[model samples]
Target: MVVGSDGYPLPMARFFPNLAIALSRETFARIDAAETVTNLLSA
Candidate 1:
């Protein structure tokens, strides 16, 4: 359970359902690809 600053349990799904949906498998793959490219460039 996630707690808020007020010491109350926060409903993450209720508050950020859209954010959860936005992080789909395709989005994760794109993010992973970007990170891998950055790491290779910096190495």
Candidate 2:
């Protein structure tokens, strides 16, 4: 998950309880994979 300038994630965990907790490795891996794909596409 990304932590914004306020030391919180962009989605704002306080409002979205679903993403508040520490994400599992599998979830993080998925996000990383997506980011990589996005970056490749952008490049």
lDDT agreement with native, every candidate: 0.89, 0.76
Question: lDDT of candidate 1 vs native?
Answer: 0.89
Regions more than 4 Å wrong, model 2: 1-23
Compose the digit string of candidate 1's lDDT tens values, residues 1-43: 8898899999889788888887786799999999999999999
Model 2 scores worst on lDDT over the 10 consecutive residues at 13-22
What residue pairs are clashing in model 1?
Answer: none
**Candidate 1: residue 43 lDDT (0-100):** 100
Name the regions of candidate 1 deviating beyond 4 angstroms: 1-23
Judging by lDDT against the true structure, name the best candidate.
1
